[model samples]
Target chain A: MELKVYVDRLSQPSRAIVIFCKVNKIDFEEVGIELLKGQHLTPEFKEINPMGKVPAIVVDGKFKLFESHAILIFLASAFPGVADHWYPADLYRRAEIHSILDWHHSNLRHGSSFTYFPFPHELCSDETNVFQLNASSAGFIQNTLLAPLFGRSLNPQAAAEAEKVLSSSLSKIEALWLKESGQFLLGSSQPSIADLCLVCEIMQLEFADETDRNRILGPHKKIQQWIEDTKSATKPHFDEVHQTLFAAKVKLQMQRK
Target chain B: MELKVYVDRLSQPSRAIVIFCKVNKIDFEEVGIELLKGQHLTPEFKEINPMGKVPAIVVDGKFKLFESHAILIFLASAFPGVADHWYPADLYRRAEIHSILDWHHSNLRHGSSFTYFPFPHELCSDETNVFQLNASSAGFIQNTLLAPLFGRSLNPQAAAEAEKVLSSSLSKIEALWLKESGQFLLGSSQPSIADLCLVCEIMQLEFADETDRNRILGPHKKIQQWIEDTKSATKPHFDEVHQTLFAAKVKLQMQRK
Candidate 1:
C-alpha cells in the first residue's frame, strides 16, 4: 500500500504538507478531515491520530505519525533524491532550518490565535451562535471564559491584545529571520518546508477582515515579499491547495451579511 | 576549531544539550551565558544569539545555531556514527520522535511556567535577582499581565489552572506515548533525544513546591517510571548536568525562609 496522508486544506500545516507532496511529486492519497465539520474529532479519525489534529499520515497502511514539521522532515529525509534544499544534508544549513521550524510553533504560528479569536463562539445556550460555525480554526481555542464575552462582532480589547501579540511575533521574524539573506528564510534560493510552514501561516490572515489583515501584515515588506516568493516557487500547487481559504473567506463574508 | 556551546545549566533545554554532548562525547567548549546576571541580555552575547536564549552552539566557532531541539538533531545528524537510535535512519521512528519533540514545545514544556511563577523578579532587584539571575528562562515569558497577577506567592487560582494544563499534557504522554512496549517512549528500550527533551522538562518540576508537583504528577505512574528509565539510560551525564537544578532548589529554599 502507498503512503496515505490525511489533511484539511483549511489548516495551514495541512496546506504545507499538501504543497510539499505535490511539489516533490511524492505519490500519496489525500484524505481530508474537515476540522470545521468536526470530522477530526470523530472516533474513527481518533484511531489514526489520537490528538485529533491534522497533517497526520499512515505509512504502508500501518505506521502512524503527526505534527506537520515532523512529517515534512520525514518526507524530505525519506525522499532525499527529490530535493536537497528542502532539507539539506549540509549540517549547518539543516541546523538553521531545524531552529526556525522549532521556533515556528510558539512564534509565527501564533497567527492561529491572532486570527481565530475576536470571533464569537457559542454565545449562549439558547441562541445558537452562528459565528461559532462560521469562524475557522481560531474559534476552536476553547476559551470558555472569554466565549460569552465575545458576541457576533470582534471584541475590541481582545482584538487589540491579539494584534499586539501578532505584531511582536512578526517584528521578530522581520528582524531575526530576514537578516540572513536572499528570497527565503535562511537565505536559501529554494523555499524549504520551513518557508512553506510559515508562509501558510501568514496565508491564514486571508480569513480576517482586510483591515485586520493589513494591520497585522502591513509593516513587514520582507515577509510580504517572502510570501510572494514562496508562492512563485511552489507554483500552481500553492494556489490550488489554498482554494479552500478563498472559499472560507467568501463564506465568512456571506455570513457577515 | 571545536564546537562551542553556550548554556546555563539551570535552564532545562541547556541541561539537555549538555547531557547530549557529554553522552555522545562530542568535543566542545561550554560557554555559560549567565542569565541570572543578565549576561545573555548583554550586547556582546546578543551577537551570538539575537534571541538572547541559551543552549545555542557556535559550530566550529563560526556558524551559530539555537533552539535545543534543533541543536540535538544537529548533533545526531552531524555525527550519525555515535549512535543510530538517537535519531535513527528508519523513517517511521524518526517521524514519531519528531512528533513528540514538536508537541513538547507547547505541552510538556509548560512545566517551566508552573515552576517559575511563584518567585519575584526583584526579590533583591538591587542585588540582580541571582535566583532570578540564575533562572535563565522563566523571565523570557513576556506575559506581564499574568506575571503581576501571580504575585510572589503561588496564586491558588493560577496554580490550580497551571495544574490543570500540566495534568492534561501529562495524561496525553501516559496515554499515547507510554503505550509503546519499550522502557522509553516508543518502547525502543534505548532512550532517544525525544526522551531527553521531555524528561528534562519534567525534571524542572524539582523547583515547584513538592505538594504542587505531586498534585500534578501523582496519577501518572507510567510517566514517572519513564522519567527514571530515561535517567538511567543517560547515566552519569543526566545526574551530573542536573546538579545545577539541585543547587538552584537550595537557593530557592533559602529565599523561602
Candidate 2:
C-alpha cells in the first residue's frame, strides 16, 4: 500500500500530520503543496482534495482524504506499527481523544492566532497573493504574522479579540485537560493525536512577534510545559517538520529589523 | 451501563445527539441544560463538562465526555444495535466520515449562520442574557435569529461575510461529497453520522428570517435534497428532537409580523 501526504508545513494542521508520520515511521512520500503559490488551488490538487485544502492524503493512488484530524485517525488506525497510545483501540479512550480533536477545531483553532484572515483588498495589490492567502487553511499566517511581516499594520481590534479567545482557550486547557501529574493531555502517559494537533496549533504563535506571542501564551504554564513534553516525546521529528515555519519566523524577525 | 445525555434541543449539536440516541434506541436519559437560562454555566453542569458546553454525557455515573461529534461516535461505538452505516467499522469509510465531521466545525459551523456572536454590550442592557448568549454554543441563535427577534439590527457586513463563507462551504459539500446516485453524504446507501451532524447544522438556518434563510440555502439543491433524505432516514426522531428549534422559528416569524 502506497501513501502520499500532500502538505504545506506552514499550515498548522499540515505540520501536525507530517510530524505524526515521521514520528510513527509511517512510510509515505511528502508532497508539498505551497499555500503561498496557489498550488493547493490547482485543478490537479483539487482532484486529491476537492476542498482545495492541504494535509490531504491519497492511498494507492485511488483513495483520497482531507482534514488533518481525519487523516491522523486514519493513519493511526490503519498503520500496523503505530503505537496504540497515539489513538488507543479502547472505545472510551479513543472517544475522549476525539472530544478534544473536535473541540480543537471550533475553539482552539478558531480562537487562536489562526483565526481566518479577512484581507483588506485595497492594502494588497497582488490579487493572486490575496486570493491564495484568503484560502481558509492558509489564512492564519497572513492574519497574525504575514500582515506585520509585509509591513501592513495588524488590525488591533481583531488581534485583541483573537488574543482574548486564545487566552481563554489556554486557561480551559490548563484547568480541564492538563493534570497535576500527567505529562500529556488528559493525564495520558503517551501523547495522543490531540496533543500533536493542538501543540502544532499553539506553535503557530512562533510566527507572531515575540512580545505578542509571549503575552498570549505566558499565563498558561501547564500548556507551555505540555507543549514541551509533546515535542520531546515526538523527538527530532517535531522540530524537523516545523523547520519551514521556524525558518520563516527567523526571516520575519530579520525583516522586522 | 447507565448513560445520561446532557443537552438542550435548541442547540443544533445537542439535538443531533438526542436524535441519534432516540433513532438508535440507545437507552439514555436526556438532561436538558437550558443555554438561555445560564444553566450550562452553573457549577453542576461544569462538573459534567468543564468546558461547560451542552451535549455532554456521563456513563454509569463515572466517565464523562463532551463535544457532540465525539459523543455521537461514543454512542455509536459503545452501544449495540446501532447500524454499521452510522459509523462503519471499516477503517476507510469511518475515516471519510471523520473528514467531513472535522470539516464541519471550522468550515461549515464557523462559516455558516453559527459564526461566533460578538454581541455589542451596550445594545442589550440585560447583563445576564448577554453573558449567557456569549457562551460559544448558544451564540448562534442570538446572532442570526434572536437579534432580529429582539429588535436589534443584524450587522450587514458580518451577515454578508457569513453568507459568503456559508455559500462556499455548501458548494464544497455539494461538489465534493454529494453524488448523483446517493441520498446521503459520500454517496453512502445509508445515512452516516456525518449526514446527521451536517444536516442538523444547516437546519439551524430555519431560525433565520425566511427570506434570508431561503436565499442563503436556496442555491444548493443537492444539499437541500440530502437534508431531506437524512431526515427521512432518521424518521420521527429527527423532527422530534428539532421541535424546540422549530417552535422558536414559529415564534420569530410571529414577532416579525
Candidate 3:
C-alpha cells in the first residue's frame, strides 16, 4: 500500500505533512477528514488510531504511527533526500533538533493549541459536563501545578486563581516569537519542526477571526516569516475542499479578534 | 573519557537513566545537581544546558543531549545489546513504543511532575511569575486536547482540566496495566520502551507519601502490582542514593504520622 495520510489541510500538522510530501515528491494519497464534522470519529479511523485523532497514517502496510513529531521522523527517514533542514541526521545535530522539537511540541504546540481553540468549553455540552471537563483540567493545573510552584499546598479555589493567570500568558509566547530574530524560528534558516508547530497553532488563531497577528506572534519577525513560508510552500497540498474551510472560517469575525 | 551525567536522584528521569546505566554496567561519572538547592540554576550547569534542567549528559566531550526519551534511545543504540526493551528493532512495534513515550513525555510527565513538585508556583515567587512559568501548558491541554476528544472546539480550559483528570486517570492507566497483564507492562516475556516510561513515572508514585498516594495514585491494586514489578526488576539498577531518597521520604512521613 502506498503511504496514506488521513488529514484535514486546515490542521497545521496535517498541512505541514501534506506540504512536506509534495515538496519532497514523496508518493502518497491524501484522505481529507473534516475534523469538526467528526470524520475522524468513525470506527475505521479509530482502528487506525485508538485516540481517534488526526495526522495519522499507514506506511506501505507496514509502519503506522500517530503524534506529528514521530510521523515527521518516520517520513523523513523513509522519503530520503528531502530538505535536510527538515530533519538533519548528524547525531549531535539531530539531538539538537530533537531537543528543540521536544520543547516546541510542549510549549509552542500546546501554547497556540490552548489559546486558539480551547477544548473544555466546547466538549462539555452541559453545565455539569462543563464543570467536570473544565474543572478537572483547571483543578490539576492550579491545585497540582501552580500551588506547588507558589509553595501553597493544594486548595479548592486555586483553579479559579490559575484561570486568571492562564488568561494572560499568551503575550509571553508572542514575546518569544519576537525574541528570535530569524525569518523562520530556530534561526533565519528554513522552517523546522519548531516552525511547523507554531504555524499550525497560529493558524488556529487566524481561523478564529482573531487575526491580531502582532498581538500573538507579530512581535516575532521569524514567526511572521514562517507564516509567509508556509503559505507559499504548501499551497498545492491543499485541495479545493480544505481551501473552502479556511475561507469559511476567515469570513466571520470571531472572538480574540 | 567516560560519560558524565548531571543528575539529582529525586528527579524521575535522572533516576531512570541512572538505573539504566547501572543495570547495563555502562561506565559513567555522576555530577549531582542538587535541585532543591538550585544547583541546576548555577552558571556552570547553564553552560551544559541553557534550560538548566537535570538529566543532561556529555559523551566523549562532544555530544550533549537532553530529553529523557532521546537519551534512553541514544544510550540503547550506542551500547547495542545492552538492553532490548529500551527500543525494539521492529519499526512498527517501535512506533507503538514511541506513541506511548511521546504521550508520557507530554502529559503524564507533566501531571506527575507538577503533582510532585508544583514548580511554577514555588519557583515563580508570585502570581505573575506562576502564570509566566506554567499557565500555558494547563491552558493548552484544556482547550486543545480535551475539547477535540469530545468533538468540540477548544476553549482555554484543557490545560487545567487535563491536570485534574490526571488524579482520576490513574484508574485508566491501571486498566492499561491490567490490559497488558504481565510482570512488565507490555508482557512478562520482555520489557519495552513502555516499561521505561511507566517505570520512571510509577516509581515516583511508589515512593510518594501515603498521604500523597491517596491524594493521587491511592495504592490502587493494579498500580501497586506494577510498582512491585518495577522495583524487583529495577533493583539491579537502583543506586544507593535513590535507596536513601526513598527511605528518607518514607521516614519523614513516619515522623509526621
Candidate 4:
C-alpha cells in the first residue's frame, strides 16, 4: 500500500506521525504543508483534508484520513511490522491508551499552543474562512516564541494561562500515568502512541526561552524523564523528524539574541 | 461480567455513555457523581478515575477505565451483543470514527461548556487542587444557562466568544461530517459512538433559553435534522437518558419565568 503522509514538522502531531512512520519502517512519502507560509490554507491541500490541517494521510491514493491520533492508530493497526506495544492488541490495554489520547486532546493538547490561539474573527467566519487562523498565532509557544517571530506583541495574561494549563497537564501525566518503574507513560516498558503524541507536544516548549521553558517544565521531573525515554526509544527517527523544529528553535533563539 | 458506570447526567460525555449503554442493552449499574455537589472530587471516586471526571467504569470489580470515548470503545468491543454499526470492525472505518471522536474533544467539546469555563486560579493550583473548578461556570451552556443556576451573573463577553467557537464547531460538523444522503454523521446508515458523543454534547444547549439556542443552532439545518435522526434511530433510550437534561432545561426555564 502506498501511503502519502502530509505533515508540517513545526506542528507537534505532524512530527509524531513522521517519527512513528520512521521508527516502524512504514514506507511512506512525506508531503510538507508549511503552516507559517499559509500553505495549509491552499485549495489544493483542502481536497486532501477539508479541515485544511497538516498530519493528514492518503492511503494507496484512495482512502484519506486526518487527525494525528487517528492516523497513528490506523498506522499501528494496519501496518504489519509495527510493534504491538505502540498500540497494544489486547482490548483493555488499548482502551487505557485511548483514554490517555482522548484526555490529551481535551486537556493537554487544548492547553498547549494548538487550541489556545486567539482568532477572534475565525470564531464567527463562514465555512470557507472558518478556522483558517493558524494555531501558532497566540498560544503559549506563540506568546513566548512565535509572537516575536511573527512581529506580534506577547499577551502575558494569555501566556500565563496557557502555561498553567500545560503545566497541569504535565502534572497529570506525572501523577496519573507515569509509574514508579516504567520509563514510558502508563508504566509500559515500550512507548505507546500516546507517549509520542504528548511528548512531541511538550517538546514544542523548546522554542521558548530557556528560562521560561525551565520555569514551566521544571516541576514535572517524571515527565522530563519520560520525554527522554520516548526520545531514546524512538532513536534517530525522533531526533530526525524533530530536526525542523529544533532548527526553528535555534533560529528563534538567535533572533532573540 | 459485571459493569459499574460512575457518572453525572449533567456532564455531556457521562450522558453519552449512559445513553449508549441503554440503547445497546448493555447490563450496567449506573452510579451518579454529581458535579455541582463536587462529588467527583472525593477520594473514593479518585480511586476509580484519577482525573476526577465522570463517565468512568469498572468491569467485574477489577478493571477500571475513564474517558467516555475510550469507555465507549471498550464497551463496544468487549460486549458481545453490541451492533457493528456503533463501532465498525473495519480498521479504516474505525479510524474514521476515531478522527471524528478526537476532533470532537478538541473542537466541539472544547468550545462547548466543558473547557471554555474560566477557572482563573485552577491554572496554577497544585495537583491536589487542580481542575476542581466545575465546567458549568463560563462556557456556552454555563454562560447562557447554568451561571444563573449557581447565582453567578452571566458574562456576556465570554458567552459571545464561546458562542462564536461553538457555532464554528457546528458549522464544521455540518460542512465536513454531515452528508446530504445520510441521516447519521460520516454518511452512515447507522449511528456510531461519534454521533452519540457529539449529539449528546449539542444536546446540552437545550438548557439555554429558546431564543439563545435557536439563534445559535438555527443556522445549521443539517445538524438539526441529524440530531433528530440520531434520536429516532436510538429510539426510547435516547430520550430516556436525556430526560434529566431536559428536565433541568425545563427547571432553568421556569426559574427565568
Which of the numbered candidates is closest to the native, going by highest DockQ? 2
TM-score of 4: 0.89
Mind giving the per-residue lDDT tens digits that candidate 1 earns over B109-208? 5424443523444331111121332211232221312244345332444445445556788899889988888888887888889999888877877876
Give per-residue CA lDDT, model 4, range B202-231, as digits (tens): 887776667888998899999899899989
Model 2 per-residue lDDT at A248: 70
Clashes of 1: 7
Arrange candidates by DockQ, descending. 2, 4, 1, 3
Worst 10 residues of 2 chain B by lDDT: B122-131
Using lDDT as the measure, the top candidate is 4
Q: Across residues B17-46, which tens digit of lDDT does each residue of candidate 3 receive?
A: 788887777889988887667777789987
The C-alpha lDDT values of all candidates are: 0.71, 0.76, 0.56, 0.76
Poorly placed runs, candidate 2 (over 4 Å): A115-154, B114-153
lDDT of 3 by residue, A1-257 (tens): 38988776656667667767776788889887766566666788767665556678888775567777677777776666677777665655566666665555444444343222222233211101111223333442334333443355665464444333333333433443335565654453565554555465456545332343344454455456557775565555434324644664554334213
- Model 3 stretches with alpha carbons more than 4 Å out: A60-64, A80-84, A118-194, A207-211, A226-245, A251-257, B117-164, B167-188, B207-225, B239-241, B251-257
| Candidate 2, position A87, lDDT | 96
Clashing pairs in 4: none
Give per-residue CA lDDT, model 1, range A75-188, as digits (tens): 888875568989887888888998998877655554344433233333211001112322212222223223444453444544454456567777887888777778888778
Which candidate do you rate higher for DockQ, 1 or 4? 4
In candidate 3 chain A, what residue range of length 10 has the lowest lDDT sum?
Answer: A124-133
Error of 4 at B105 (Å): 1.0
Q: For candidate 3, what is the DockQ-based docking class?
A: acceptable
What TM-score would every model get versus the actual structure?
A: 0.86, 0.89, 0.73, 0.89
